[model samples]
Target chain A: MLQFAAIILLMLGLYGLLTQRNVIKIIISLNILEIGLNLFIISVGYFEGGLAPIFTSETPANPNFVDPLPQALVLTAIVIGVGTTALGLALARKIYQKYGTLNLDEMGEN
Target chain B: MLDNIEVLQVLEIVIAVFMVVLAFLAINSKSLIKAVMFLSALSMLSVIGFVVMQAPDVAVTEAVIGSGLVTSLFVFTLLATKKVGVK
Candidate 1:
């Protein structure tokens, strides 16, 4: 069920991207799409009775803890994403200053 | 595997349809910005699918970087440009 919902969200983002002419709206749609994917990933890790993957001297024998590897990877991805977004934005700003428009049709690639 | 085959089959069908739709949207969009957004959405869906297949690390990365950071970058770029061309 959750998977289905995630998929729907993805579709919606895509639709928005394709349909929207404004650059900002397209970016927003892209973000929406990413959120859907993230939700799906987290949902996959959900086990009916899984516990948090924590370690302690007194509680080291539990075998039903959730996986921690994904969490770590996700954190790294988040940082990278931030960097990429910043760079892209910077580039966009530069383009705007140089060209003074967002309409791709008008900005001939000369 | 056979016991829950029916449920898995349903899931597979749903996922397949979703992917097809998203792929089309990403590539077929008229505007460059819209296309980028669709691409992000596609990335996110792939992350979720990975998680469902027992790959949590991939899911996390997709969620954070793909959705969060990438989108921001696209937005910034959009802001930089008022239109596709300089009028």
Candidate 2:
């Protein structure tokens, strides 16, 4: 069920990315794409009734735990998404300032 | 009850469906601010969905950076452009 949702989210993001002409909307679409990818990574780490990877002396030495790798990877990806978003928005601001319009078609004309 | 896994699964699916609708609305909205608002709604739903998926850390990050920080950044940039000033 989770995987199905993730796929739909990915397709929605791709649709927005392909169809949107405004630079800010493009950046927003990129964010949606990042979210879908992140969700998939976290879902890959899930284990039924599994504990987090943290270990305490009171806990059993060998216990079921959700995979920590994908969580770490998604953490990194989320930060990178933020940086990319900031950069994209800055560029959009510059484009708007220069072109005085947010439409891609108009910006393309000289 | 919220403790039931089945209930949680149902809730997660509902949120995901809402997010998909919001994504389409966001990308297709004629007004840029309306699009931004839809994006904000999408971010909020994603945060909730992340929590439902057993990713509390990711949920926190998404809530702070995705919904709050990114929305502010969008608004700031929109203001910076004279053509999109506070509209």
- Fnat for the candidates in order: 0.23, 0.52
Model 2, runs deviating above 4 Å: A54-62, A108-110, B1-3, B82-87
Tell me the TM-score of model 1. Answer: 0.50
Q: Report the error of model 2 at residue B19, Å.
A: 1.3
> Given candidate 2, what's the lDDT at residue B36?
81
> lDDT for each of the candidates?
0.59, 0.81
lDDT of 1 by residue, B1-87 (tens): 554656655665666467656656654556666666666766666665555545555666667777666765665565446443222
Steric clash pairs (candidate 2): none
Per residue, candidate 1 scores C-alpha lDDT tens digits across A5-78 of 66676777688677765444555565556555554555566553454455556655746766666556555655
The weakest ten consecutive residues by lDDT in model 2 chain A span: A47-56
Q: Per-prediction count of colliding residue pairs?
A: 16, 0
Residue by residue across B19-43, what tens digits does model 2's lDDT show?
Answer: 8888888878877777888888988
**Candidate 2: residue A95 Cα off by (Å):** 0.4
Q: How many Å off is the CA of A51 in candidate 1?
A: 1.7
lDDT of 2 by residue, A1-110 (tens): 66666777788889989998878889888887887888888888885566666676877878777888888898899899999999999999788878888879888584
